[model samples]
Target: MSVHSLNRLIELREREVERLNVEVANKRAVGDRYRRSLERMTALCEGSGASAALPPALSLNCGNYKQAMLGMVDLHRQDLALHEADMAVSQRALDAAARKQEVFQQLLARRQAQLLREHESREQKRQDELATQVWWRGQR
Candidate 1:
């Protein structure tokens, strides 16, 4: 096809690749945060269990312990939400990248076909010129 259309396709592919990279990075970050939240929850459970063995007065700030656990629960929910959002974004990016990759493959095929045609045309013209030169020399 035309150069302009090819260039546009290339630009689209580049943009899609960029967007995909961003999304992958974001998903990775979200996964990391979710894992950390899980770790935090485990740590909180362990801490509470350990503190339960102590006397009430010294059981790891008894008055505020419930509130702290509640906060952790809230964070756990938020982390889950972030993870889901990240997954959706990652899926979209993957889809877009796949589409762009297909377009790139099509562009490559078109270029290859054009090159083959040009090569054959040049070879045919070269042979014709050589044949004409030989015939003219023979005539002379």
Candidate 2:
């Protein structure tokens, strides 16, 4: 491809890579939040056992509290699972985008190098022709 076309393609690929990076970051943040939420749920469950020293009136709701905690923990677990799946997919997508960009960069570099070599070859040929003309003139 022409250098101009190659440059445009590289630019497009760069933009795609940047966008994918942002998406990956966002996914990571979401996953982190879900992980923290799960951790908090676990801590709460652990701490609930220590609440047994409460007054009799307050202790009466222990069973209900435990049941509710169990439900919340289950919900958190489900959410964490879904988040993990999403993170995996996003990570794969990011890797693909990065690879594509790398390919474009390599292609662009090769094209630029080829152009430079061609330019040098043409300049060398021109110089040789000039030298031959000078020699012919001196011989005359």
Candidate 3:
């Protein structure tokens, strides 16, 4: 393939890598939000005061609230786990795209080098022919 085509392919790969990076970042942000929310819920559960001095009704209400908050925290943990899994997949995709871009760049470099050598060889041959022609004319 031509160097131009290889460059285009590399650009495409770069875009893919960039897109995957964004996806991973967004997933990480979501995970962070989930974690913060989980922390708040856990703190609320821990801070609940069901003191024996409190009225029975208030104590019962506090117990119910703690149970509900615990359940919400568990749900948040599950959500965070799922988001982490998705982020891992995005990271792998980004790695593969970067590797592909590197390979294409290497191939383009080799091709350019080969083309330069061929051009230099042709120029050298032409100069040698011109020199030989000048020598023959001098001999005459």
* TM of each candidate vs. truth: 0.66, 0.87, 0.93
Give the clashing residue pairs of candidate 3, or none. none
lDDT tens readout by residue for model 2, 1-140: 88788788878888887888898798888878977887887787777784568787677676568778879989888987887888788888879888887888888899999999999999999999999999999999
What lDDT is obtained when candidate 1 is compared to the true structure? Answer: 0.77
lDDT of 3 at 65: 90
Better of 1 and 3 by TM-score: 3
Best by lDDT: 3
lDDT of 1 by residue, 87-112 (tens): 88788877878787787768877887
Candidate 2 segments whose C-alpha is farther than 4 A from its true place: 50-60
Report clashes for each candidate as comma-separated counts: 0, 0, 0
* Greater-lDDT candidate between 1 and 2: 2
For each candidate in the order shown, give its overall lDDT on alpha carbons: 0.77, 0.84, 0.90
lDDT of 3 at 116: 98
